[model samples]
Target: MSDALDRRRLLGRALAFGALSVLPGCNYDNLQHPDFADRALRAMSRWNDRVQAALFDPHTLAPTFPASAITRPPRFNAFYDEAHVHVVDGASWQLELFGNIAEKRPWRLADLRAAPQESQITRLICVEGWRVIGQWGGVPLGWFLRRIGADTKARYVSFRCADGYYESIDMPSALHPQTLLALDFLGKPLTPPFGYPLRLRIPTKLGFKNPKSLVALGVTNVFPGGYWVAQGYNWFSGS
Candidate 1:
């Protein structure tokens, strides 16, 4: 419990620092400037991502937990607070597929449900240094990609969410067996606060990589930096 509290405190401080670093006066882009601090930080972030990518084993699965280990009311997280959570209307929801795909169409909730589906109890490790276990059910991301005839050779798979959130993942992680276009959590349809309709559940990546309330998914070779990534967070935030 004390460790969790400590992690929470560290996360709070990190978030505060990130917020300040991106303020109007802060110039993170001028790496050649005399202030070497920002340059060093950016270098470290890139190094971390490279090392993780080199060490990543696509076949190795993240550890799963028993039902008893599942966290009750999994902690809610987003760029905004709970009150600002995007409320998606199920009746009007349609998922757009574009980019390097052979088929370009809008998918409804029924379309996803009809695909091959499975469930897993996995941990969601946050960049904030905390983690929680939850049961998520949906179609395997790879299966869905193949079903859509997507360009599997693409370097990245990116997502756009209803709440103005966006994120991208490397092809290896996107094809991982544990990665899911999650439609349900804890055996029930996801609620508004928890990203209703669809969420990306990736046990191998940090919480931020798992975007919520997905409105569009694209396959591309170009890097589509996420909301946090644009604000100087690491792009490949693998767990």
Candidate 2:
């Protein structure tokens, strides 16, 4: 418990520094003032998000690598150890869609496999500073969103995972060309440890933004805070 508290405190301080660095003329000398500090951090975080979004170029693409650049025996990461990885039954798995979508129907694995497929060899950079290059193939999120008649202008696209992890991304990032509903990894269907059946494979953001074993997706204007974002990480963590 002490270790968790220490990590949270460290993260809080780092975010406070980020807030101070971006917003000039802000006073936060008294760390004892929790209320004031919390308010300042919230405001600064939102401001940082706006700045990042404004600077993001929809036309620009993340750098991609060749097949040879793929990481061998890809690294497995999650809140749980590999031994505890959730095993999703691919045959029984169905993607549920709701909120601002005209087609509320569930999508089966066959449906996704039959859709137009795109593949990319890209890097997945973790916030912890490790990165791995891998090849992923799946449906383009932009095309899928349009096909389902989702509100393209919606502020947020939220995802619920099989392992209880949840995340959200802005509409622009969701519609980015590199954003994919990844079905295959390393030229084959994903194994249980790597989010089998369906996972998001967005190269534009950090690894956590690319949720695995996606069960439900929703489009909404309401702010859908992610697992890590709720724990103080920046919401718009653009790579």
Candidate 3:
């Protein structure tokens, strides 16, 4: 049998043999069932998430590079090709707010720009084993979170994007100083192929966590999974 099939069979047997009992709130029967194997995989993913979260340091910052190190012609990445990237109208776009926040009003581009901005030259590490360094500038997310009176104690902060992508981060990761609602890339406003208007630029996590073309944001205690995460990518995909 193929190695991939062998691994799957091993995982199924592990679940049946109680190796998946380490996962909290999940019960597995001692039977070799297809559904049991799938649940076992999910349980393992959740366990990995908890381990990464425990190892994460909220105060530790990701390494920053000088301007000279910035990658030229920054690599454009998405689930879709650049030719199919959705163009958004910056003038008509509004960042809607929801859940556990005192401010429910939508914020426009100008409002976001008015906030104090920070710039960073940081590396974007992809889970596919590629990395690129680029310059990004925007309002610090932690500052904005406080400005909106969001309950920082909430467990998760979720995002909705123009391209139908959705993602969520832990509260500690959300409050990381390097996390930004990035509006500028390479000292210029983002273009359509990039995350025009606004995007999340989280240096500490893998590239997929930095979502593009943000349309909505919310703070909640409930779990809000991501597009790739639902397909079995690690939710706490730390660098």
Candidate 2, residues 156-234, lDDT tens digits: the string is: 9999999999999999999999999999999999888899989999899999898998999999999999988876688
Q: What is the lDDT of candidate 3?
A: 0.88
Candidate 2 or 3, higher lDDT?
3
As a whole number from 0 to 100, the lDDT of residue 32 in candidate 2 is 39
lDDT of 1 by residue, 1-239 (tens): 65433332211223456665554444433423413445566688889888988888999999999999999868998867899988999889999998999988888999888888899999999898999999999989999898889999998999999989999999889999999999999999999888899999999999999999999999999988898776567888887
lDDT of 3 by residue, 154-179 (tens): 99999999999999999999999999
Which residue ranges in model 1 land beyond 4 Å of their true spot? 1-35
| Model 2 stretches astray by more than 4 angstroms | 1-34
* Local distance difference test, each candidate: 0.85, 0.87, 0.88
Consecutive 10-residue window with the lowest summed lDDT within model 3? 25-34
TM-score of each: 0.85, 0.88, 0.86
Residue 8's lDDT in candidate 1: 29
Which has the higher TM-score value, candidate number 1 or candidate number 3? 3
Model 3 TM-score relative to the real fold: 0.86
Q: List the residue pairs that clash in candidate 1.
A: none
